[model samples]
Target: MAAYTGPGRDTLSDVLDWAVVRGGAPSVAVQVQDGDGTWFDAAGTADAATGEARAPGERLHLGGISQAYTAATVLSLEAEGRLSLDDTVERWLPGALAGNGYDGSRVTVRHLLSHTSGLFSTGMALEVQRRYGTRAAFREHRYDVWRREDVLRLAVSEPPAGAPGERFWYSTGGYAFAAAIVEAATGNSFESEVDRAVVRPLGLTHTFVRHRADPGYWGPHPRLHSKMFFRDGVRPEDVTPDNWPSLLEDPALPPLDTTKANTSWAWGAANVVAPLDELIVFMDALITGDLLPEAQHRAMWATESTKGAHWLAHTAYGLGVYELTLSDGRTLRGCTGASTGAHALVLGTPDGRRTLAAHVANDYSGFPVFDRLLEAEFGAPGFAYDR
Candidate 1:
């Protein structure tokens, strides 16, 4: 593990400066820490229509980043000897292996966290979801199961994309498979295991692995929200209320849906959601020796970074989180999230310096502004927004 002692700490006042300059109406919160002192700022509005500014410690989804937390719990269980990291699936869940090509035996814990476990398919954003933003909307209007077995079954019917560790691939389904492994090994659901191992110990009060509680609104056109994938923006459009391009051509060896005109499905890959502060605390725990024992923490970041859609300045992956070397040579281990009108980036040095930053809106304006906020806090010059 890299013990990073960050120098010349940045303050939250700098972040507020950038936010005041570039932030339009989107709500944003930023907190940056050094060894002794910390700086914090919350700006903009929480609700766009009402112009309600967000208070400190507001909630937002962490997206697939929760997988990193889930991965840690699985690894912890392995350390306790409840199950070996190399254990196979058939030994635990017998009949669950229906049509999926995933051999629980072949899919190791090492494979799951590092996204080496070649699961069935990369989940897709369905058409109904494209029209409706939130996962709740998907369930209300459409009948999508978004099950772990669905993709596992999809893989069971197919062949492995390649042998585990052959290359780098990002699949939430792989985490789903790993979650299943956790369930089979401990006889507890992934949600329960996470709540037990990670959330409770790390003291993440706002971290939620399950779905968000929806405010009841029966209008024909309700607000769309997605709890996964932050790409161009965290707009309702970015929520994949419809099919995304990457979801179409997955390596799961799809016997069907080879056609590009298919819909997206919810899977374990993109379900976890959380707030920015909780994410910051979780990252702090990973750095301060609350999450991993010590040796496991070292092992989690053992592999070298290869080609993937994303990587952090290219170090390695122990499990789910990416190891990124910052411009100042500090290792920032965390994830980026964009779902519906929400965006998240939780970053910190292994020593103690941490920053929890995020924005939530029903539009796309929040992203660039957040980037500019990061720039100001990180000592980068130039205002991000042209306006």
Candidate 2:
């Protein structure tokens, strides 16, 4: 609902147009807040099939950015004395993480939230999927469902990369374990807890945790596409209608249409959706301490080394959030996320004076436009990156 006005609107529009022209992202939705004014804009198509143009306020998957909400929910429960960051995974899930050289007894909730758990990632399973899970394979088993245990089992089927808290290693499986902790401690489903702690409290009516039976998007949501298989002698695919069961099946195939995929595989890791406007609001609230208590908020930004774990430079991992030190001295606090065909980046100044939340209907590689857009809005000095 925010409107871009004034002289800068033209610059912003130009940057967005350039994104579609050069970044290869078919669609992009962005919202920015500066002091008291907010701006929202969208460029390119929402659905290739319908030739629908992207619209402001349309929802898109938050991808790994959903980790921020999960972290906030856990921290809220901690504030309620229902859980503690130091609590070990074994304390809640018992022997849930016992095999493949993984020891849950030594992995604390903080470790999981901070990506220091060193547990095997679902990416370990993905190596197999990429080889055999092609588009045709996905069509055959698209609707298959996976339970939480199934996800945990797949993650641990391979040996852990490191010991708990020894170093930073991004792992969606760790967050899935954290979600299980939320359930065990709160006596509520992960979806309900996130709703109670983050979504409802923030009045984010457009956001929801997705499930197998749930349609991926609500009204007017953008259809997601990807260039995942371009390197494999295949063209870009519209992965907006099929389930992601191929993630667990054999003869791994190319990235299938994940738009309607059952997100149970992602669960606590990356299954949240909201429009750019709502995400901007969420980032503003998060950085300004509206989401968690002072201690937890501080903890969320207390980052550790993520060297070699992330693609971006000057990046560090915090509790479910990423601390990115811009070329300027200012630090942007929020997270970046990617699903099959959706990529999101939400960041805000510590004082909440400026916020930027942008989503592109493409994969992780389709993010240069966002960087350029950030530089356009925040000045070139704030977003100097290696390309």
In model 1, the worst 10-residue window by lDDT is 254-263
lDDT of 2 by residue, 145-164 (tens): 66878877766777887898
In candidate 2 the C-alpha lDDT for residue 137 amounts to 40
**Model 1 score (lDDT):** 0.53
Candidate 1 lDDT, 1-387, residue by residue in tens:
112223432444555545545543234566555555455556655544566655555555445566677777877897788876676656666655434344565666677677776643343323333434333343454433445565455434445556666655556556656777787788877777888888888776766565312221111111222333223223433433133534332222211101011121333344554555567777777656677877777766676564442333344555766655545655666665544444566656667565545544423444565556555555433322111
In angstroms, the error of model 2 at 242 is 28
Worst 10 residues of 2 by lDDT: 234-243
**Which runs in model 1 stand beyond 4 Å of their true positions?**
1-25, 94-103, 124-148, 154-161, 211-273, 306-315, 360-371, 379-387
Which candidate gets the maximum lDDT versus the true structure? 2
C-alpha lDDT of all candidate models, in order = 0.53, 0.75
In candidate 2 the C-alpha lDDT for residue 12 amounts to 76
